[model samples]
Target: MEEKSGSLVEWLAPLAFILCAGWLTWHLPAFTLSWFPPKDPSQYDKLSALFARIDVTDSMTGLFGGYADAVDWAALLLLPVFGIIGVRTVRRAPMEFESWKPLDRLAVFIGRLTMMLIVLLCSVMIYEVILRYVFEAPTLWANELSLWLAGFVFLCAGLYAMQQRSHIRIFLLYDMMPRWLQRVCDIISTTLIVTFAFFLVYGGYGEAFDKFYRWETFGTVFDPPIPATLKPMVLLVMVLVAFQAIVNLISDWNAEPVIHTAADDIDQDELDRLRAAVGADGTGDLDVTRGSIQSNTPGKS
Candidate 1:
């Protein structure tokens, strides 16, 4: 019973987020134009007027107007189905990927989604090239679509990097610290990241909400919902990053001390292969010398 309940919750969480995303996408125009209608044109300040100009009024002409019509509801509804697949894929991912927990699984899912976007981006660019050069015709949608996909790719990549523990850090001093001290440093770093994420979500909430409410566009000929969607996405991704940070901190709190050394950094397998290659000539083998050097290197071992 407990196992089944746990599985249900795992499915439910991503479903909730997907539903919320779809709801916001569907109602963004209504919320922006009707719920928080812009003030009178004469009373509008410079910024207000600029924003007002981009607001969607007609639901039958512009991007927002054709959003429901152009969009395939069946395909839109598949987002959660994709999320389910992502979660399952992560759960079964290689051990090196370290996707055991919910947070790690979520990050993997996002990373997989990013990979799909990259492929889509490449395909779009190729199609654009064919149209522009081969057929002597150009497209307005390709560039905007590529940009849109790239933005999400970048955002998802950040989350994936956090999960993989691949982000840059000056760990020179950190590797020298005692185990307890390392834990302390880890706590502090995670705390700072969480605080930053909090501020990002808090400060940007109104802006994101407003942009979505107004159905803000890019003001180009093929104007897209770049501003409206991206604003909210920034906050949403930040929240995920923050959650990953906390998960990492908790998971690694009891881990063994990671003391770095010159030898620790060296790839022994590669060095052995090199030694074998050198010895193939029947000349002096460097394995003994290399072993001595590694033994003398400064480290706990």
Candidate 2:
């Protein structure tokens, strides 16, 4: 029987980890810097801009009027999370990957985040549609939020694509090369990826840092700091992608040579689904009894 990986429970740990990190990412820095609050009392940091300031410091339920309690709890919670789930999900999917190094896990985890963010982007657009059509009062933030999520989604998807080895490659002659030359081609490709990452990060570091420090915004009514977040995120994800490329090179060093043909692009699983959809065996016209039974079932027509 073929298995599917569409279960939500399998994603519980990654979701928890992202949530805990987000909550703490906001609360910790805000509280720690409260003693000598921002040089400008009215200014908002990038995190504060999105969430507004929650003043966890003075809330009775927020614990000791601050984030120490929250941070400590998060630490305790996350330690066991990654440890228990460790390198991968508890219930591995049929196609969920067998070897998950730390970098591989990070890539997969970010890929999942991209999926959730895509859902969030769709939700934001739907909300905008409803407001504009039904309520006649569209939100300023919705479109910008979608753009921001989309930027990160694209970056994360690139990282995921690299890890999955699904990126485009022209292998017309490369496929015919000897195994040693193939490994040579892999090394050259990996080096080129590393070179690209290095130049990108080095050249963009100053600008990304400056924008993050200044909390640069889009200057609209919503005024999201897309510049601040996306700039740094690009560099960070680029580094992760470069490292993942190296990891892939190392992992696949001994992998068997891959041969490409027009038939190779055909998806067996999809064909199986299509076969099931049409109630056909592998030899589509051979199973007469099977077809007759399915045809007789009340809804087959």
Q: Would you estimate the TM-scores of all the predictions?
A: 0.68, 0.74
Give per-residue lDDT, candidate 1, residue 267.
71
State the C-alpha lDDT per candidate.
Answer: 0.68, 0.71
Tens digits of per-residue lDDT for model 1, 109-148: 6765676568768999999999999999989889987887
Give me candidate 1's TM-score against the actual structure: 0.68
Q: Using TM-score, give the best candidate's number.
A: 2
Q: Which residue pairs in candidate 2 have backbone atoms (N, alpha carbon, C) closer than 3 angstroms, thus clashing?
A: 57-65
Model 2, 5-32: lDDT tens digits are 5566556765665566545543444444
Candidate 2: where are CA atoms >4 Å away? Answer: 1-9, 21-92, 96-98, 270-301
